[model samples]
Target: MTLEKTPPASADPSPPSASSLAWARRRGSVARFWKEYRTHRAGLLGLAGLAFIALIALFAPLLVGGDVQSVTNAPGTALEKPSGEFPLGTDQFGRSLLGLLIWGARISLTVGLLAAALSVAIGTLVGVIAGHYGGWFATVVMRITDWFLVMPTLVLAIVLATVMSRSIWTVILAIGVTSWPTTARLVRAQTIAVESRPYIERARALGGGHGHIMTRHVLPNVMPLVLAQTTLGISSAILTEATLAFLGLGDPLIISWGGMLQDAREAGAVSSGHWWYLAPPGIAIAFVALAFTLCGRAIEAVLNPKLGVAR
Candidate 1:
């Protein structure tokens, strides 16, 4: 007796269109990144708070309509409680604390962004070349990185600032130059991994030049790591700048958070019980640094899924 055989399930005859498949993959990546970021509630809150502070900093002149460095007529207004006249109260010199905080935000964020940009650009170049070449070039670059790694960054920065006359650009350039070694090492390691991939071999077989391979292939793949590092680097740069300023090695003309802390220290604000003088700027520095750190960690979890899995 012959039994009737069940027919096997037929697969779909048509495959997904190229455009449709590409769009789907793009959407998936974005959604995954979003989900990973949303998993960090503290990071999100820090980002929001930083955004608010940034807005205030960006619009300080519009918000308070006076020179950030200009002395006000409120000399007798020291330690006034937060009121309509002075929200966040006044410092020892009777300058508006709110104004100072906002202006300081501008300086901190500017230095942070500029230094990060410079470091990332230089580091990416150095890393890509060293990793791609992978011989004496790599050895030399890595040794240079180790050299900087051994030096105490703060002491080096202080020495540089002292020699350079403590200009704002000097501080920014110093931070950016000094900080690139770590980022270079990270990028080189990432590039080494990516350069060994089959696609890189295919590109090489197709006669793609080092410039093309580095720019179009290697750089894009290592960018997430570079970006995460940049965020963290910005925080370090700001802190270093502030520390330099506190040591009287920062730009004297700029009313950065470090400058405020310097003024407070000189006036003995710490012992005077006028917490208003030092507290706001100190909090601003701490909060801004915290924001960058949180954001960096969130991005790291997204980019390095191994870290997430380990957690």
Candidate 2:
């Protein structure tokens, strides 16, 4: 007779891992973010407006001509109302309003982009170094950043522009130099968060150099924040340039939108009901500013899924 029958052993069953579940959740989150963004009305409108402005700025010369900056046509044709010859009408110098607006875009957009770029570059470097290696270096860098933060950006920019002379580069440098503090703080925070991740730890364990860890690992993760900051920075920079111009700090030779507005006010165009002189440039400025705000918000949402979902 045989012994009692033996039952077959059961294979081990395991629970789903935390890491795998997290990855799946992340994928689902991304899918939901795209879906939500696609359906967002403000996001689409903002995208379209931004595209329009960018296109116009990019192709200004082709669209109008370099004549925007030149003083041409009749000598006594200052402040002419909208007519067939001058669609947007003539300024105090009889230069084409349409041309001036288009040309102004070049200068305005240039200042905005250059300032933002400089800020981003400087901020990124400062942030990366401070965040990757903490302690005294972080304290020193952050203290400087705090000093800048305490100083009002617009007023400081104005002072610099006035003191250094009213040139495009002067304004750009002033805005750029002072602008990076906020960006630096933002980037530093993002860098600090990213540096704590497991992949970063792995790189550290493998004896990865600081440069490698920062460039290859940290930067990629923090880049989205930098990019979002850039969009908002463009809007801020443009406004700064306009304020400088309105205060007569811009290049006298350059007929920017703000300059046009200033001249219009001085010429009493508003009192004379010559709305044409002020309306176009004002609308253009508002349009561009609104576009930037919208696009920036949209980009921020897209880059930060949690923020997007919250909204």
Output candidate 2 Cα RMSD.
Answer: 8.4
Q: Which runs in model 2 stand beyond 4 Å of their true positions? A: 1-37, 72-76, 270-273, 309-311
TM-score for each model: 0.86, 0.83
Superposition error at 38 for model 2 (Å) = 3.6
The true-structure Cα RMSD of candidate 1 reads 6.9
**How would you encode candidate 2's per-residue C-alpha lDDT over 139-222 as one tens digit per residue?**
998999899999999988988988997788998999898889888988999999999889889998999999999998999888
Per candidate, the number of residue pairs that clash is 0, 0
Q: Which 10-residue window in model 2 sums to the lowest lDDT?
A: 67-76
Prediction RMSDs, each to the true structure = 6.9, 8.4
Candidate 1 local lDDT, 1-311, one digit each (tens): 99999999998789889999989998998898888788787668767877988898899889865564666665445556566777777766677878878888888889888988898888888888999999987999889988987888787777778888668898888888788888888999999999999999999999999999999899989989998999888899889888988989888777899889998888787887778778888999999999888888878887887886222
lDDT, candidate 2, at 210: 94
Show the lowest summed lDDT stretch of 10 residues, model 1: 72-81
